[model samples]
Target: MTPSTSTNLTRIVKFGKKPAKRDARNLKLSAILKAPPRLPAEYDFDVQHNGIPTPMFGNDYHGDCVIAGRAHQTLRFEDAEQKKILPITETDVLKEWHLENGGTEDGVYVLDSIKLWRTKGWKAAGKVYKIKAFAEIDRKNHDEVKSTVYADIGTGLGFSLPDSAMTEFNAGKPWALTTKPPNKKNGHYVYVPGYTKIGPVCVTWGRKQQMNWAFFDKYCDEAYAMIDAADTKKKKSILDGKKIDEFLTKLKK
Candidate 1:
């Protein structure tokens, strides 16, 4: 029996893979792992923008939060008027980049993942997975570029959560995170498509999770604003010819 198109449409997301490495910068972010990070009280504002509609994906057994977040950014950007926002296959993230060391059940790396995007691109879901890639969305400081980037491009925000692993574990929602995961083992990452009634709506595990304005303000340490390639004139790739080795050297301490 042939699988219905609708059944295939729901297969965009998969279980998350664990984080690959723990870097000094990430550890620093994790050190301040108190629940409900302190922030200004009056700043109870929420903002939202456009994004692709991806479903709640699970890592199942692997720790691939990095890939999951990247998938969110990639799929949402690629989501054109298709029935599904992110129409892709599991092999895209799982199998394609084996020889180049593109993926791992252990985890995904920020710079390494960039290399994968540059080298192999990504697999688009259809009758068969199609090769597709997007222009690099320059990594800019949220404070410096947030004004220009937010509500514009769907991007990635890297931050560490408090002791809310259990919260995330049960609810399948991740909010207030950092590049350096707070737990010391997991460097959690999420896709920030846009804001909500009170705060930014984060994407993970098929859920468009929204966090409190204060929580987002305090834990959001590092942010990378991503725009669809066609949306901005920044056509040139930011990570041109850069090697992941350089980032690895810095991550290891």
Candidate 2:
């Protein structure tokens, strides 16, 4: 397809509730979607330099792709989270998930978490992901604002792409895939490490996955990228997982 064509940016990650003011995020991403894509390349989320490597974390069966995805994003930078980048454990992801939802088997929801964290400066399920310090990469009217949660790339600490889905970019490969009937396990929220010759590279489950321009055209629905704000800190909020189950139960009444 040519660079001017528009593609759907819808998603498959389920949310019990919907989000607000998603127009700007979606519209900006649509333009990105229309941009020309590069081709024939490989990406490693580990950020290797010639041979040296950086470690990353993976997900578990209980549905923590969102957490794993966020963790991988942090590992992309040398000093993400205001400290040295390290492999963020799935347990770290799970612990924060508990704090956010009280550990009630909520799985992962991209829209609600992203809008709150990326645009409104709320904490991600994992405390390590401080949306407060990160800025939204793109917005419809970003320059008009004097001071805002979102900013240009140079100023933001790290950016996040919200409301995207994981679809099968290639068939019969080790790479994960999401289809129209959408594989239940494949649907996910991923961290955009950056673009590649193929298209955008998402760090998912501790590995790099490519969504080429054509793949994005067919499966990509919505997205937002958060950039680092001017300030950066390694401090992370902490939460206890054991109490999460009990806390959520108490709220039911």
Candidate 3:
């Protein structure tokens, strides 16, 4: 479905395949295993902004996911209807606007650049302005009845949903709980999208460590190589779970 944007809305977001894949990679998996997991992992990017990294949406043109925070602060009211706000009807057109202004025409936050506009002072004018959004990994709570039986069957403990799964998981679906958009299970975040069920399967009975270790074992060589060969200190930080969260959180803010 297309996104419906009104004066009250701030961002537009959607999920779909892209002819060109995003560049997300799983260096952790590649490090131990010889093979490199798919580039862009499972998510696409297509956010419209000046210099910000947006999702690279596919030709399908699915509606964009409206970023729901500060983007709304920039809404413009129509002169004809003071009580009602204008809606951005076209994703492409809205994207165009997002590129020009710091925000999307639909009001999605798409800043061209992030800079500390102010160097000092205590006034609002001295403060820097930037938009930040973040998604914490969480899993759906399973029934106690099933948990006991499948305690080892599913050890839901992962930082975030594979980027591929975030779209459907984020949609207003039965599984995507309203209170927790990404849902949480145990200590890990879980989002069981339709796509996660496909591609590959392996039998295992270990706990979370076992699962991650097994998965990474298959592509350890590639994952480690990416880490070792990383030229910049910035890239190396991705390997550290804490650093990844810090980076993502900073971007969201």
lDDT of 2 by residue, 19-68 (tens): 12244323232222211222225333334322222223324334445555
Best by TM-score: 1
How would the candidate models be sorted by lDDT, starting from the highest? 1, 2, 3
TM-score of 2: 0.50
> If the candidates were sorted by their TM-score against the true structure, best first, what order would they fall in?
1, 2, 3
Better of 1 and 3 by lDDT: 1
Q: Which residue runs does candidate 1 get wrong by more than 4 Å?
A: 1-52, 80-86, 96-104, 126-151, 168-181, 230-253
The TM-scores of all predictions, comma-separated, are 0.54, 0.50, 0.20
At residue 133, give the lDDT of candidate 3. 17
Candidate 1 local distance difference test against the native: 0.43
lDDT (0 to 1) per candidate: 0.43, 0.37, 0.21
- Alpha carbon lDDT at 214, candidate 3: 27
lDDT by residue for model 1 (150-252), tens: 3234456554455463355355554444333354343456876555445656676556676655566555445544334322322122222123234335555
